[model samples]
Target: MGRLIRPDGLAVGERVRFDGQVRLVLAVTGRSVTLSDIGGTPRAVPPALLFANGDFEVVDSSGRMPLPPVSLLETLPQAALERALWWEGHILEVLNGLPPDAEAGTEPKPQYAPSRSL
Candidate 1:
């Protein structure tokens, strides 16, 4: 038996060792996992049998996954854009004592006046 690793967290393409052999993970579903041997022979087994008593260990982690990109905030829907703009204005009012689009000579909001407690 090998040291325990989180089998449920295994990803396709990761290499794991068990039964004195190293296999490449092919797929992981809710019920079973598919693995392939070095000869390209495939085996499907229940996670329970494969990981019984922690009989498996991750040998290679070259399949590490990356988080998806979410750098486009300006593409938000109209409602989300409005809400984001409202929150930005509110935050700017609180931090700068004036709304983000306030005119240069406009007076600060009474509740967020910079002359007050800061």
Candidate 2:
């Protein structure tokens, strides 16, 4: 078995091939890598799926190859942003159950409230 590679280490705009398909490396981390499909959709792939190193190339629409700076936040689309926010909310809910920290002794705010009418 191959060791896992950090997805965040991959150069932005670096092309890579995985599972017999080609994709652009958007982000890399120790556990997984984020890639952009040919259609420009971002997908997360585990290191196990990455087979060949040079199987892909970095190229733009003009075929000129260049590596872009890694910006994970910039790569997130509206839908992905929403999903991340939702998951974060769930995590916060779990954290709220724990005892308050020394700095702050209040619990998290309620998620929902009864609507008041005039």
Candidate 3:
């Protein structure tokens, strides 16, 4: 668990719930975090609201690469880009763990219940 002082340490593209709706981190600055919906519409988000529900990581975003390259993140201010990239790599490291060859999404699939004959 992360502290509010660090704003939950969320990385871009990591799954998180805000107001009960899942959102993606488009950008993060020293002061605020930017979130986007599936439609890519962005909104200014405060760090305090990010973890208020203790609902960080509602879904494991580790399977896929999250967020756009810094080049495509035109919405972010120039100064925040480098830091965002650094944070992005750091988050991936933590989520990925120590095994370099480990598969990203290895969670066992759920088995469906067999249907009974009517």
Which residue runs does candidate 1 get wrong by more than 4 Å? 1-5, 63-118
* CA deviation > 4 Å runs, candidate 2: 1-9, 52-118
The digit string of per-residue lDDT tens for model 1 on 1-118 reads 4444554488775787877787777788878878775545578877777786355877876523221112333568978876866776686678678876898899986889987785
Which lDDT tens digits does candidate 2 get at residues 10-115?
5545666664576667676767778866545678866655633434333332321233322544578978766765665554345444222324665444542123
| lDDT (10s digit) by residue, model 3, range 61-96 | 565456564556667887788787767665555555
TM-score of 3: 0.43
Residue pair clashes in candidate 2: 6-28, 6-29, 6-30, 7-27, 7-28, 7-29, 8-28, 8-29
Quantify all predictions' global Cα lDDT against the true fold.
0.68, 0.51, 0.59
Checking candidate 3 for backbone clashes, the offending pairs are none
Candidate order (lDDT):
1, 3, 2
For each candidate in turn, the TM-score is 0.45, 0.34, 0.43
Q: Which candidate ranks first by TM-score, i.e. highest? A: 1
Ranking by TM-score: 1, 3, 2
Better of 1 and 2 by TM-score: 1
- TM-score of model 1 (CA atoms): 0.45
Candidate 1, run of 10 with poorest lDDT: 63-72
